[model samples]
Target chain A: MIEVKDISKRYGDGTVALGGVSFSIDKKITSIIGKNGAGKTTLLRILSTQLAPSSGTALINSHDLIKNADEIRKIIVSVPQEAKPIQYISASDFVRMYLSARGFGISEAKAAAEKALRKVGLWEFRDKLTAELSGGMKRKVFVATALASDADVIFLDEPTTGLDPFSRIEIWHAIKALRGQVILTTHYMEEAQALSDDVIMMDRGKILSKGSVNELLKGFDGLVRVEGRKRRKMAYKVGDVYVSYVDRRKAAKFINEGEIIRPIMLDDLFIKRGVNLES
Target chain B: MNLRYVAGYAWFAGVHSVKENYPYLIAHLALPLSLIFIVGVLSHGALLPFALAGGTVMAIASDGAGTAQELTYLRLEYMYQDFIVATKTGPIDYMLGEIFAGLPWVTPSIILYFALDAVYGMLTLYNLVMTLIVSVLLVVSVSSLAFLLSSRMKHARLIGPYSLIFSYAMTVLPPTFYPFNYLPRWLVTTLAVFPTTPAAVLEQGFFGLEPTAWYMLGILALEALVYFAMARSFTRWREK
Candidate 1:
């Protein structure tokens, strides 16, 4: 459980990464979804104890982020977006070493490393150097560390980015199997929809919405998205295309043959509300 | 500081660095060995003692300063600093881990120079122990400065040149390769600002080349404490 209170972060050059925002998280998995520069990573970093909030503070598992950062650190693990394994170290060694640094004994670290590498489907490649592994496998090495950790919470910053579809699904399952709180930031709406118990949508430096998948998509019961150039009774201009959200019965009238028509996704939240994400 | 985390990280990082970058290990030896060669060939062994003592001090100080690049790379490019910040690892654990990680690169050079010191008939039990003490102090002081330098570095590209400037200015600009007695008293006092100056002076005293100035040993220890304290307080382990 986490409670963020009026947290704001402003850099030295006057860049406000996070505005005054307050929210509480009590989900098994919560995904922060936003476009680039939406303050998603900034917020994750602040909560993970890697960055200090400029104005306010947060309580992670009842420990204050600033006042009790050291205690908080013992209960959390974060995999940064740009994190890469040391090239020369084997995957098994990297994970084991990470566990060791987290205070696990040698045998304990080895067992945890084996279990984690197996979960991420890299147990067979455990002895191979990270540089010898594929890009996706290297990413899995980091995920394995998170899986091996006994921490109460795990923060992943875009863990599945740049991975192939199969690799992404594998990582999704690994994350799903993790117990306790897992907070992640991702740009993929499908990822947020599929894995997160709750989704927190952000725009600029503020929270736009927060709810379960079904709750967030409650209003679009029988609606489908018809994307094309034709104007409809209810449509919003998204870049060069017009996305019209209509009842399934009325969607046929607006769509021409071979035009794009798909089921409604969480992205429609922006289009239905006339919010252009690309802008 | 969590000593357990520090020791674990030091072993992990140190072993891996040596294995993966074995070829680059020679980078640490090339400069000192080259200086020894130049001094040996030109002076026909007359000034071999200066090269032996100065080369050893230079190697230790430059290696200490060069650790900034490793810290910067770990922080900015690999994001290892952020990854570990969420662990039980503290700032002091990370700093000591990085300093010890660089030891494997410098260890062979230290042994070689000490062996050379023995061959040149300057090695004694007391000199050996005192030189080792001075070497450790030099590393702590210069590496603390390196930690400070890396913490303020924003870009990885800038760290390479910046650390080079640091190594040269702190190790070479000081009269590390020559006798302190060669310079005037005013210049000696002025150049003592660099840790390498006192470190070299202390080493020269241990080798019996210069009269043992016990005060220089105090200066090196003081530098280590001041720089270590400054680095402990100033380094940006957590972003604002």
Candidate 2:
């Protein structure tokens, strides 16, 4: 649904934000993961038609970003990394104003906003000033606003940055339930693993890797762990089927006794694949 | 003219402004009232020129401050980006909304001051109407200028001093306090080049000296047109 071709962004003093980055996103959750200053937010902003790239082109549903920004705006909704509620306005009133501004009738906007808020579990607090709400609730308001807009594509930049576990899960589920194409960025590896159909890892203003979880896991060698008497160690091997890695004596003890070990998780596999967990 | 949308945004802007800056509103009204009374008591007729100049200064300063606050709040708080991404409203809608939003707070004080002048037998209906027209032009021109500045400058701190300077210049550079005849011809011509000077000239029309209302109105219209065009031409700083 979106095509970004060779997009590059350079600031006035020569800070390269995105260097000829290119990617295509379809009607599924595409999670962009990167370290700090990796240009994930920049890529999402470009896709949302918020920032113009210095060179290259971005197309939303076949419309050129520069030539057809208004049309692209109609179909794109962006949840900025620092998304905040419009203080002094009630949540319901803010949503209604936004909808009305967008050309929807008051009743229609109200209905959609109510439904969207209810889905995010914030309908009861609709009339409260957004500034009075907690961080999680405010984020929910922004999420609800985007969902209510019913745009063809939604870009969420760090949607669950400061939320509690429950609120994060709720937001993740809400995002999971969205029907349109979604491009989201986050530092949370678990979120990318849980919600995204595909993942794009970025580093230093470039795409380091892009693929499904299974495809990404292919780069790591599978490992087997054998737990015996007092000490436990990991045995690494190259194969499709799971193998039992243990000391010769432990292997004999385990295989002879017909015991089974659990499969390794992606986190462990990632560490085993020479990815520095601390960094 | 999409009055419904215009009204919606105007209502949004006004209500938000009131809620956010209620203290400023109180101050906005109180400061002027205090100044008007003090000047009225202190200098008899001598204070009229200073009061007029000060009132004009207050009006422009208030308008600029209010506009800066509104635009800065919208941009920094991410409200502006939300509106930009929303399919329904354009930048023109925001511009008109801001223009209408700023009028009510500014108009009442100007009218009240002139009404006081009338009660004291200082102004006639002709003066009232001309002053009203000039006030409207001033508000429109300042509002447009504010919007243009907001679009160009991202931070509010930088805008405050610049806007204050402009307001000061608008009030003092023209013959707002004293007679233009006393000033140098070159100075008068230079002042005439400013939109605020023409607006002040239009206000002079209320005093029985029909000073170029058409020219002032034409300049205001041209300025509004240029500002609106510039506002439309500028691209917002989006996520990309």
Candidate 3:
């Protein structure tokens, strides 16, 4: 479990990155959704003991983030937004070596590395140099490295950013298979809705909303996405989709031969919070 | 810290790292060998033990700095340090892992030095023992200094050329291949504080043909300890 109380970060020139943010996350997957420069990375970095917060405190498994950082380090693992291979090493070998550095014996490290690679569907290509691998494959290697560690707490910053859909799913599956608490930040609303048990929506370095999927969407209960020729009359445009918070019968009436009507999702909730989805 | 646990697989890990960068290892070894080749061809075995000692330490310092440089890149450019900062890998484990990974890169130089020493009849038991000690100290101290310097930089690639200069100057300008009496008193005092200064002094003396400062050996041991602590303290990871 993790508890963050009023954590704030200000840079050297007095730019506030995070301002009095607080949240408690349990032993479950939580998604932090934010646009670029919303301070998600800063908050995650501070909680993971990679940075010092200008004010406030955080605790992971009852250890103070700053005071017991070394102890915290022993129980956590982090995957950055972009993970580059440290050398041109084989993916599996790199994973094994990192595990070895984590105090695993040869046979145990091999077993763990193999299991992790397989989890990410990379076992067959384990011998490939990371430099030779595809971008998604390299990202999966980072995911495999995180999965192999078996730490109690894991932080992944935009784990699937820039990856294709299939590779994204593969990494999501690998992340799902891990048996520990996970905190992930992403710009993909679908990913947050699909994988997170709870989601925190952030904007301007502050959390705008925190709730489960159903809880967050409760306010948009009457809303439905209507797509077709007639959707323009009673709808608000969201990218190519048309959405409106109205009676289901009214929304369905606008659906034509080529149209589709579906219930509102996290995207509608985000739009309701005054954000333009395209941005 | 369970250093035994770290050692259990660190050697194999080091081997894997070395195996992955075979080109780097080859290139790293080739340069020093080429220099030794040039020395042998020029002096026809004239600069025997001095060349051996100086070249051996030069290889260790230059190549040892590489370990720190690579680690620094991993931390800065790749953010790999963030991946490992958590986990049970202690500082001792990290140091040993890096040092072990770097050792094989310097072994070729060590072998070449010994071959040159044998050809010139400079491989006395005393010189051999003394050279190994001084070489190890120089490797550890200079590598730490490199790590320290690398840690201070925000950008990657700044440490390489600078460390090269530091290693080159530490070996060439010191008393390793030259006589200590050639320097003024102020210069000697300034160079004496360096870990390699005493190393060169002792190596020259071990050959029984040049002046040496036996006390400088103790100073180098002290400097190595201090530099090790500095490296540990300086090379810390921060989100910045």
Q: If candidate 2 were superposed on the true structure by all CA atoms, what would the RMSD be?
A: 6.3
| Comparing 2 and 3 on DockQ, the stronger one | 3
Report the Cα interface RMSD of each model, rounded to 1 decimal: 1.6, 3.4, 3.2
What lDDT tens digits, residue by residue, belong to model 2 across residues B1-240? 445566766676565546655665565566556655666677676656445533653565466556756776677666555545545466667767777777656656676666766665667777666666666656666666666666666674676776666655665566554445566867766876555666655555556443454666677567656655666666353433
After superposing candidate 1, which stretches have Cα over 4 Å from the reference?
Answer: A249-258
lDDT of 1 by residue, A120-203 (tens): 899999988888998788888988898899678999999889989888887899888776699999988899998999999887
lDDT of each: 0.85, 0.68, 0.76
Candidate 2: which stretches are off by over 4 Å? A218-279, B1-5, B16-21, B34-38, B49-57, B77-79, B82-88, B122-125, B154-156, B170-185, B192-194, B207-218, B234-240
**Across residues A47-104, which tens digit of lDDT does each residue of candidate 3 receive?**
8777889999989999998788888877888877676865467888878877765677
Instruction: Give the per-residue lDDT digits (tens) of candidate 2, residues A1-279.
Output: 788889899988899999998888774888888767889988777777667789998888998888888788778778788777777777876776666666667678879999988888888998788888888888888778778888778889999998999889988988876767888998888888888888887777888777887787664445344433333344333232233344333444664555555444334343454333345
Ranking by DockQ: 1, 3, 2
When summed lDDT is taken over every stretch of 10 residues in candidate 1 chain B, the lowest stretch is B1-10
Give lDDT for model 2: 0.68
The alpha-carbon lDDT assigned to residue A146 of candidate 2 equals 76
TM-score for each model = 0.95, 0.81, 0.87
Candidate 1 lDDT over residue span B1-240, tens digit each: 667666666677676657777876788888788877887888888767977887768887778667898888889988988998888877777888777877888888888888988887877999888878888898888889999999999998899889888888776667776677888988888988789899888878778888988899999999999999999999998886
Candidate No. with top DockQ:
1
| Model 3 CA RMSD to the hidden true structure, in angstroms | 3.8
